[model samples]
Target: TAKASAPEGEDRGLSIVEVAKARMRDSVVENRGQPQTTRVTNDEEEDDAEDEDSGQDHGPLNEAELSRMAAMLSASALVVASAGGRRLRKLHVDLNRILDGKGNSGVFLQYVLSRLHGIERKSNTRLNPEADLSVLEPYEEALNLALIVAEWHDIVPQLQEQQDPYVLVSYLFNLAAEIGHANRVLRVKDMVSNVAEARWFLFWAAKRVLEQGLELLGLQSVEHM
Candidate 1:
């Protein structure tokens, strides 16, 4: 186990494991008492978006914003985990590639969020968190989409065991590409009828999975990238 020296001026000794356990306990308690906000109403969503946009205006970084940016940068560095192996190899660290908004992380977030916004805007209502995906049974593409969800579940344990962020990141990037293709083929936006509920739930599932994977990588899911 890792170890750490006690803080200066402390009378008692402490280890890193103890410090970590204490922090985890504190976090659990703090979060346990907070109510979860799962659904956002239309008005509330617009207000929240406006607030976020206002915060994004040109300005000096506040402590919290700086901290989040630090976290994002730190998180992005984990992409190096993708290059792990026994063989000696030189891996170029390309800031441009890593930070590309059109690349893996950015594309995944943008496509999923855009589809979500489209659904809410066209439907004139927020999605039910408990929305039924079973309605997606008939369509072959939906089955393929469901397979993605199942694939995510299967891969998660392997990711945890292997500690390979590349596998997860690549999975998300490819999933985003596949969904983009499926969306074009379905013409979800141009349908003569209202947006299909089943497809909405499918996209919702996709978004949730992507967000979960992103969170695992210590990444932020931005409203606008």
Candidate 2:
């Protein structure tokens, strides 16, 4: 298959989809029953972090790095159907942007799952559905955040009927943004009994929604970054 897709004289070795599938296999072992510090392990990770801390050069990723970028892109296309979209008349693949965690990229999507995994580890317990949702203050930011998680089911049949995974992709990115903002106000650990329990449950639900969404997209849905 890689041979069929490769341009003339370019021995790319592996297709993007193959590479992503390989990583999905790797993720099962990598995320087995634990929370972790999931940072990207590629060549650029160290430089990217250092560049963020100091104002240093963020050089371009080489062809080898671009293949890694393709893995994320291919997998994400199966979900959202569009980074630029799965079907395009003409598209330019930007290796830098796809690998960027802050942007609306697959890495950012994984980061959300990683944070939810951290919350679960911190709570050190499973979801208690009986947790008092009514206790959530009307003005609490998490109130809105939970509402988004609640929409997960509503969006599913649409994706199936329309045959477009991008809808779920949109939902997930939005969900991640809301949860990231709300976590500042909704402390999961070291809080009152009911509050901690309720927030933990909320996050647990969010984490599942994220994981399921990614799984539907045929991605690994990492426990860490």
Candidate 3:
């Protein structure tokens, strides 16, 4: 039962109840619009928080961890060289050249083999007698070194044209295998049966010899000497 309060001049005045009904209608409209604004604000805050958390989770590795990882990789490479054996042979050839005429070849070769055998025994990873020919192959670095030695000593004539020394070394190993010197030939017919094993032995022996030779020359053996 709301009524107009007064008619002044030609205008009608609204009653208190009508004014209250109009205010209530405006309030409902304002409330419906306000929820969307509040929801949008909440959504934005959630998105920002997720972004911050993602950034925190993806931090870089620390310096100590990186150094330790590098050391472990180097150790693994050394172990792989020991297991494969070709690296040993490459070492042997290099050492023989360095020692050149100072030591008996037969004795040196024997010593190299024994050292390699000892490393294998320590590793507890038995080499398969009937494994694939290409199983646990020689390290590329050692093979390259052996090739370089051959080229430097003029063992092969075609190596003279090698522009990139690294490439030449790789080529020599491949060619040697193709031409049947993959196992080093002691004589025309007496080819070593297990070149990979011999190579590993040679590698360790060569490392020892080089270290000793450096000491003799009054220079410290740095890295692999």
Best by TM-score: 2
Regions more than 4 Å wrong, model 2: 1-90
- Candidate 3 residues lying further than 4 Å off, grouped into runs, are 1-104, 130-138, 141-225
- Per-residue lDDT for 32 in model 2? 32
lDDT of the structure predicted as candidate 1: 0.49
In the range 8-100, model 3's lDDT, one tens digit per residue, is 332336543333233333332332222222222353443343222111111122334333323332222222222223321433222212122
Candidate 1 scores a C-alpha RMSD against the true structure in Å of 11.3
Best by lDDT: 2
Error of 2 at 124 (Å): 1.6
- Provide the TM-score for each candidate, comma-separated: 0.53, 0.64, 0.18
- Give the range of the ten consecutive residues with the poorest summed lDDT in model 1: 51-60
Model 3 lDDT, residue 71, Cα: 38
**C-alpha lDDT of residue 170 in model 2:** 79
- CA RMSD for every model? 11.3, 9.5, 34.4
Model 1: per-residue Cα lDDT over 69-175, one tens digit each: 43443343333233321224444433334333345544334435545545444444335556555655656776776788779977798888877655677777767
**Rank by lDDT, descending?**
2, 1, 3
Q: Where is model 1 more than 4 Å wrong at Cα?
A: 1-89, 103-118, 125-140, 187-195
